[model samples]
Target: MLHNFAGNIEMYGILDAIASGPIEALTSENSTMVGVGMSMEGIEQNPIVYDLMSEMAFQHKKVDVKAWIELYIARRYGRSSPLIRDAWNILYHTVYNCTDEAYEKNRDVIVAFPDVNPSLISSPLEMYPHYGKPTSRRAILREKKNAYEQPHLWYSTSEVIKALELFIASGKELSASNTYGYDLVDLTRQSLAKYANELFLKIIDAYKFKDVDKVTSLSQKFLDLVEDMDTLLACHDGFLLGPWLESAKQLAQNEEEEKQFEWNARTQITMWFDNTEEEASLLRDYGNKYWSGLLRDYYGPRAAVYFKILIESVENGEDFRLHKWRREWIKLTNNWQSSRKLFQVKSSGNAVSISRSLYNKYLRSES
Candidate 1:
């Protein structure tokens, strides 16, 4: 995100003066919120600008509105032009008062034009503050009730699907030129090849027979097939396939590729803890290689806490430690528990002693 705030600050001051309100009230002190709102405003005004900003925002997780406006004006007009500030002011006022009525009135013009003032697309909903002084529990519950009582603004599932179909059809029609058709075909092929290779590897891994020779032979054949597919992919000189084919070819040639591939393919393997020696042995082997390393690298100080849970599960011979270490890992990673749950190894034991020791180690490390 761009941080050139000079323009925004000047704009905000002017806005504050017009309203005769505190300047700080017009602008958020929170940098992230300000950036998000400004970026969204910038995008809504111009679809081309919106497309670029949205892509950058989704990838980089932030946007600088002032810098973007400055660059945008310089590109469209000229560098160090006075009209830049004037145009920005006009756009700002338009966006500041943007409402549902305005959107309805201007919808046709916005859809038909390449350049749009951001205000034309602004939604009042986006202006709502995300955070502020804490409210009482009762007030919060009341707010929730009021929200639920209001008509739902989001599209239903079926409506969304229909909308997506329309979008795809429109995109295809718009890009029906020979050049674009070739690009689309190459993109589709590359995407299919990538998915197919991933699915093939997954199928091979799912067969748990410890026959190393068979697995190795099948893996080698799969790799060869992938290489051949990539070779065919390279014949398509479209932009979409060029980058993907190049990457796949590099992967095929690189000797150290396997290690990188292994890392990419690393997935959690869940084992239910049974007190049997056989279960213990399997758990130890798998845990040491995959689970232990993941926890240490990702969780750092809390790694030992996860390790303790694994040990405890095994010692107790319990069918499963419900939630257990895998749950904590999900919390730390802030990801869905689905993948982590797959790797859950359930074992029975209230290994308080082990947990205590690990907790102490974590504390010491933190200190």
Candidate 2:
């Protein structure tokens, strides 16, 4: 979103002065331009320059002024002409070079400024104030509050659903004519995988579910689904789930209580199931019979064959094959949930069965 305005010498002078020292020197055109250029060039070379540019181009309200300033600076330095084109190039390269990292760093900004187009630069004055000084602490605080209050700052359940809707609507177009649709599908899938594996764990901890064992079992199933989709659910461990888990850990009254919860959730599902006959019977029926059949029907004939293998292995007490099928099931479940496509179906039960069947099919073919 860099503007690079060629014609505004005075504005450039003011920019230069602001860059060089205090706002007081902004009165002189020559000094301002020089100050602005020096400051801008320095910004351009920063490791985070691309991120800052993305913020300006894709997120900020004062992009027009920023664009103008960028153009003015670029033109003054004879770096490039047609500031819009330069801006486009900058944007393209930034996206291309950083790839997913760019999105991670500037997702909040991009979502906030979804309508941004680098080609829309008409005036420098429109782009200037966003980079300038604040009048009061109250104004700064207001801006911060506004930023935190923005609805699209983080991926919410609604946004995830919308992304899925786009994926389903695009349908065959994604695989055939529409490259953008395909990209959207891929991006949405990636985002969902991240959310499922990372954010999901946080939700479990936050809610402190009484049926901790059931939660753990469900979580494992979800993870399995991810693997079945042939997608990696791993995020930058330090930045993703780690922060949420750490926050949850901090919330616990004592380490012993935290360990107790973790043990109950992760290791006691089977024991809990044994104690609850009705729930156990329902799970067994659903997991072994109903869901298994549903999976075969949902994924198609090839997948049905795989489900048959899994059933046979389990029924005949073939430990190795049973183990293999179990692993494959987990992987498929993870993939299905991670895609965020499960919501398209009305029934969670039906979705689970379908996912299991598809995964079974994938495994049989791979084997």
Candidate 3:
């Protein structure tokens, strides 16, 4: 079975569930397996999550994450020790082990974009049907009260930052060995995203305070992280957009068919499932991926547009026109070839060692 069926971040344990089968059925000897479908991208994001699940299938055992991680660290890298286990402990209890009820708002950086103005109903990361359409003034007043509720408030901010550092250090420890390249790429991707999430919240705070200079500075930095993320993911063949697009192209017999197939591949990782134009937003960003081309080409431009509006609105002393922007965003979401910008097809630097030291630099209070 899978989690996040509604299409946001699922717990890292769904990997475990896939291997464990139903709790009642665990007593039976029947064969069970998981497809982990719609995962056309790289295996880099969460190898540990799935590796544990795979072992669960054969061992048919429950995970004492504490104990299992020791073995995991040893196997993935060439070594393991107290440092390794300590880091995994933090992840197991927090980000990896949360339930929907307990951590309702804990979301990725991109997913929390709507917090800037909860009334907007959609972030630049997505184009929700409710975003462009007009709503009553009563609804606006309601959102004003709740807009402060953001996903980043899920964990002890300092602790989460520490866990991200742990991942980066783990990447460094394993770099020279390079025992499992997939794990390296995945760790870097996670570190980059965690760092971005931290900055994302700061940007929102800056905007709240009308710190235009801070907004402009942090906005550029956040986009830089997104761009760097694309570079990191490019190390893996599965994370490259060229092959992803080509896979779609191979299924087409004509130019019209080609366009449709391309749209299918792109949407599968984005909006997901089949929906009409009016209902084009079901599960938006639910399956969001940071593939080579999608990050630099698709997500980057969207962020640029958002910060531009914020900076301009602040400069001119006028309110931001989110609806107008949403209309334009909707148009881009429909088109596959919004630009011809070239993106890195291969990763630069050692994805592991290069991202190694980021732990100290990013993990801290926002002071």
Candidate 4:
């Protein structure tokens, strides 16, 4: 499987570092490695990213990432421009160059907290949000791990933000073309995700401080960010939640079987291996998603509970018992689901145009 961002590059020359294989192996005796495999999981799901990587399976010559990405955008949108190529060139040197600690550094605490530091057996409320004694929570771990992986620990956020702006500007030029619509969405998703990651900390901090008003405001604002995401994704089926849900339903012989398969699909993005019994359930929500249906229905509800409890606790001058509510949240999600009771799947507008408009409206509204 191909590797992705592991850590931040605090110093120059790290971009050249990932591609060089050991000289010993490259020059050594017979090697039988024909090709490589890629697990699409834990990836951005951008066809271009995966497509280019797949192209490498057959590429023999040592390819430069800049040139390779240039060829990709040229072929991808049925047009080529220096702006396009250069935007990707910057991407390669920024987010695309994330260190191995990248994933761990950018871990989403709201969804991935339960398994942040897994135990052989996790107790109820064992990992619930609390401020007092320092625990081995992902939030805690992230604070330590981040120091080694960001602007100082990883890539400069300002630079990545600029690259995103450039990519978005190029996307506006191809507003009428369908060939690269999904690609544009992928770029837009990455841009918005960057903004969201920055907001995550502020949201959690409000919760930690029991700042009820701030938590209520930020929680709703956070949910709206995903809603904005769902709107962008509705432009194409590639990002729609319907296909994933439908695939699970199609393989089922009946409603019960459908529910079973649906549960796994829904569970995968939500509770993950959320079984209260298994140790490996430690991986719960590791691959959490913000798809149309999941974001509007599942994630939004989970967050609303916290917002409600926190705000109410602040008003009542009492501590919020996270244990009681977390169990209810678990019970609410522990099932196979079907329905778009939240967002649409069919295309209703031009994907690229939406990107150009929303890129400024939502993702950069913070500016």
Per-prediction RMSD in angstroms? 23.2, 21.8, 7.7, 7.3
Best by TM-score: 4
Query: Per-residue alpha-carbon lDDT of model 2 for 221-259, expressed as tens digits?
Result: 544444433221111121112232234345568977655
lDDT of each: 0.28, 0.29, 0.55, 0.55
Off by over 4 Å in 2: 1-155, 197-199, 202-212, 228-367
Candidate 3 accuracy as TM-score: 0.70
* Model 3 lDDT on a 0 to 1 scale: 0.55
Give the candidate order by descending TM-score: 4, 3, 2, 1
Better of 1 and 4 by lDDT: 4
* lDDT digits (tens) for residues 54-116 of candidate 1: 344233323444555556544443342443244343333332222222111111110111011
The alpha-carbon lDDT assigned to residue 100 of candidate 3 equals 37
Q: Which ten residues in a row have the lowest lDDT in candidate 3?
A: 126-135
**Between candidates 1 and 2, the TM-score winner:** 2
- In angstroms, give how far residue 258 of model 2 lies from its true place: 45
The deviation in Å at residue 361 for candidate 4 is 3.4
lDDT score, candidate 4, position 79: 83
Give lDDT for model 4: 0.55
